[model samples]
Target chain A: MANQPSIHAGVRALARLKKRRRSEAIFRAFGIAAIVFAMCALAWLLGSIIGTGYKAFYQHSLTLEVELTESILAPNGSRDPDTLRRANYRRIMQEAMFTRFPDIEGLSSADQRAAKRQNFDIMSTSGGPNYIRQMVFKDPAMVGQTITVRIPTSDIVDQYLKGNLNVDVPEVQRKISDRQIAWVKTLRQSGEIKAGFNKRLLFSTDSRDPELAGIASSFVGSLMTMFVTFLLAFPVGVGAAIWLDEFAPKNKAVDFIEININNLAAVPSIVFGLLGLAVLLNWAGMPRSAPIVGGIVLALRTFPTIIIATRSALRAVPPSIRDGALSVGASHVQAVFHHKLPMAAPGILTGSIIGMAQALGETAPLLMIGMVAFLTEIPSSLTEPATALPVQIYLWSDSAEQAWSERTSAAIIILLMVLVTMNGIAIWLRSRLEKRW
Target chain B: MTENTSKNIKFTCRDVRVSYSGKEAVKGIDIEIADRSVTAFIGPSGCGKSSFLRVFNRMNDTIPGCAVTGDIRMDGEDIYAPGLDPVLLRARVGMVFQKPNPFPKSIYDNVAYGPRIHGLAESKADLDEIVHNSLKRAGLWDEVKDRLKDSGTGLSGGQQQRLVIARAIAVSPEVILMDEPASALDPIATAKLEVLIEELKEKFCIVIVTHSMAQAARISQKTAFFHMGDLVEYDETDQIFTNPAELRTQDYIMGRTG
Candidate 1:
């Protein structure tokens, strides 16, 4: 020891110190690189989704002055509701298009018929006709008046106006013909056709026509299913956690139960969907594709997640708190319910919210339960047939239409927003309710 | 040393032993604690002083695989009798831990918890009176009277210990067990706690386990020395400190051995 050189600033020691600093710097660089990579990936995903999805929120529409002929709408001069509903609104729309372009009259009879058909294809068949029917049915006295009304164009025209469809492609391969394109451009130049917010996308339900599709039904279905999932999973999960962590005796049977619970959390979620299919749909004869069945399947998938989280949260409470309560002559139940459970509340709530978010995004299990059906009507009750948002997105993504592709991206954005909001609430609640102890 | 017996004995233990998962922590022992007096159990760490103290209120029962055997009677009633609920026994015999463990609740609620759970107070006014009197007896009323609504965990180490003691006394227990209650406090806090314990012995039988021999000498009237899961000696505090008959007790008090 006496012969050893001074440790500070020695050659070997300095080399060792330099090596240690270099290794630390390398580790820090790797960590920063990892984080930057994750951020870049997230940014790229969001950029692509927004680029395609923002166009689906708006559409092009033509403002037409339609002469609502009383003779065709109510030939008998009867202003009854059923008579007005059964009116020939389609002919009125066709004649209005014919009036806009009277050049069709100069062509041959066969050419005239073809040109008229191409002209009618410029407007949305369902949206425009349904709007005229609802309007005239509500106000029967306006039957003979010529009124200016805005009507959505076809999905192909809407796509072209949004600049998603390329005009440089050959005419044969393009969805829009040169004649229909010419009419659309003419109307746009005259300030008759304009791009506006797509109200149908938010208010209406699923439709074979992409211009009339909406998320209203699927959004409501997701809400109802999440409600049921929370109602069933939270109480049961927290109760089971309390019993296992605080009251259950440590024995072979309990150990086995605990092991199985952990294993259950890791099981494939679609297996739960199959269980629901066999027991709920086939055996119990519950309605297929109903939110109740969907909710129950999701509850089974989320239950073990909630249980694991709650057990860990309960374990996090220091043993001294339980001992303090017990020493004061509080019963085991009172000790757990009064002191420990309250302390574990924030953690349990955060876990439950995260689990619910996972259930919201889950699609595979929902598919097995027949929630992937193309439901058009919005469900009014738990037992009614419904489809969830993720399932709706999956269905739309599988469509062979460019408009459906944009709609699918938009639906994905909405689902992501809901998940982000739920996660945000979980973070906010954890911070707000967490105690220092 | 000559046996020092009290006519008003509160706890009588015969061949009492405690084990955890078949490993004995506290071997067979016999001891009697007098009512309305302070008895101190002093030994080195892990000598089973705390385990023996926990046995009085059945706190050890909460530990998995921990078992206590033999006869332990309180006021001539077998506390381990089949019909005697541990919950009721705990209310009658309260315990304070080595670390101050006040619940994360208002000061009033912390003290009112015991009485509220035992139904000792019937109304809000009754609960308030009980909390007030308990805190006053625990020597914490003057310091915390204005902050009854404040969280009990917000107090200092000394105050939290006193609040826990007040919580124990609120249920009107006949015996209070303290397991090294002042070991975590500073010198000044320890002095304050010793004074509070002195004042409390006038009403309830107090049993304490301490690592500090000087503290045991200063605050306890009777002393029990433990070593390697056995009680080496039990006598008057003055006799144990001055004229202990056992070699292990002498070595321990003389600071020659742990």
Candidate 2:
């Protein structure tokens, strides 16, 4: 053996080593290229979403003082809430806009009607009427007083003011006429048109007018759906994992069950929606478009992911921990619950959170369950008709309006933020609770 | 076996055998383990010494498809009887493994685990006392007394092994099974463990499986040599090393073959 020549002592060995090093370097370059490509894609996606959607967070509003004509708002002299609510606030708003731009009155009667309608389009259709009604309802004494208030501009004027509309396009091609653009410019010169934080976008419910639309209803629905999903999926998934990993006897039946569970994780999420529609909605007579049903469907979709994650987490715990506990005279139950489960908790929690995040962004199954309904009132209970954030994004993205596109992008940004936050929480929990063996 | 009949017998085995998934590991064997003494089972790897050691406390029951068929009695009680609960039996017979497997908890909790599970200690004070005494007996109290609240996993390998020993001792078991307990330890730790085992045998029946013939000769009173799942020799430690009756045993101890 001592007389044997060393294979590693020559130029051939060095060349072989250099070749191995070069291959490793090439592999590393490929890995880096893949990562760089992924990063570029993500950055481009975020940049486009933010660049188009950030404008939706700020809105142009017209600040004007308009005399509330008592005869128009309270013709019966009855200050009752119902009488005030049913008053002609739209006429009052039109008069207010006409007073702001008096040139519309000089046009011919046939042209004057068109000019008045164009002038009225400068103010938000819903915001002005809702604001005046709320004011009159809150205080009947203010019927004759001139109130200075900030009212949201119509969606077209808002787009024009925010530099989103193409003024270079012919007046016939643009949604906003050149006359309405002049009125917006006059308001801007007088400091009456100001851009401020779009509180309506976050505070109000869904509206036909994009200027008045907000995420409040869909956000609430998402919260409720996620709450139900977590409540149902976590305990059941973890319990099933624990039973299968620690207690179930190793046999053909158990193996078959495990294989089915793994296969269930690979099943398309829409299948769970169909199952929910069949079992939970149709057979159970559950309410449609309700968060409870949506949550149940999402729970069905999420639990399989959670189960796979939890089983892997439980498996990651070294068997020696079980042996250690067992050798100390602990029963199998105690050994698992006291030692193995605690050790597996971090991994399980990370898996559950990731599952929940996936469920939050899910839209197709929700579409099957009728969660795509346009909900205007924020859901007050789990059974109320509701639209989740992803569903809202889907609904808005399908709308045939330029304004809805930006709102859709804004909703996407919000959904991405929520997913990122959930992933952050998952990472934090894994780091905080993970124990070194 | 006849010479040890004068001492109190803790375990009596008749035609003991172990198999994993229908594959025989430990062939039929008959043996008696004396109480309050160190008995060492020495062999090369896969000789079934570790598998046989696990049968004492029914640790083999935890492994899937591993079966032990034997008439094993402890103090005239059939340990393998169907009515016997392994959990209760294990409290009376503790075990330490090859690698230090301390619970990922504080040093104090590691020692208190066995007593807490078996409900041996009546109060926190009693549990603390049990932990202290166990650590002292394991010869680890002085090294870890100041940091009892620190994680057991953070301790050095040697300290971790002693902590595991302390955890086993905290239960006050009548029998202690050590399966190559010092195989992962350095020479100094192994020496310390040998000394601790020497002290432990005065009260507990210590059954150890070791690959080190010198370790067995140094600490054990009775020595059993296993070869190919068979017990080739069982005699006084001195006799087994110096004048083994079987040629296989002689060749193994003399380093002629594994």
Q: Interface RMSD for every prediction, one decimal?
A: 0.7, 0.7
The number of clashing residue pairs in each candidate reads 0, 0
Query: Tens-digit lDDT track for model 2 on A1-437?
Result: 88876899678999999999999999999999999999999999999999889988988999977788999988878888888888999998999888888888789999999889998888898789888889888888999999888899999888888777888989899889988888888889989999999887788899889999999999999999999999999999999999999889899999999999889888898998899899989999999999999999999889989999999999999998899899989999999999999999999999999999999999988989999878789999999999899989988888877788888898898899989999999999999999899
**Leading candidate by DockQ:** 2
Off by over 4 Å in 1: A1-9, B1-6
C-alpha lDDT score of every prediction, in listed order: 0.92, 0.91
Per-residue accuracy of model 1 over B1-258 as CA lDDT, tens digit each: 233334599999999999999999999989999988899999988889899999999999899999999899999999999999999999999999999999999999999999988899989999999999999999999999999999999999999999999999999999999999999999999999999998888888999999998999898889999998898899899899999999899999999999
Clashing pairs in 2: none
Best by lDDT: 1
Judge candidate 2 at residue A17 and give its lDDT. Answer: 96
TM-score of each: 0.97, 0.97
Residues A1-437 of candidate 1: C-alpha lDDT, one tens digit per residue: 87877887588989999999999999999999999999999999999999889888988899999999999999999999989998889999999999999999999999999899889889998778888999998899999999999999999888888887888888889988888889999999998999988887887899989988999999999999998898898898889888999889889999999999899888898998999899999999999998999999999888888999999999999999999999999999999999998999889999999999999998888899898767788999999889999999999999988999999999999999999999999999999988866
Residue A242 accuracy (lDDT) in model 2: 93
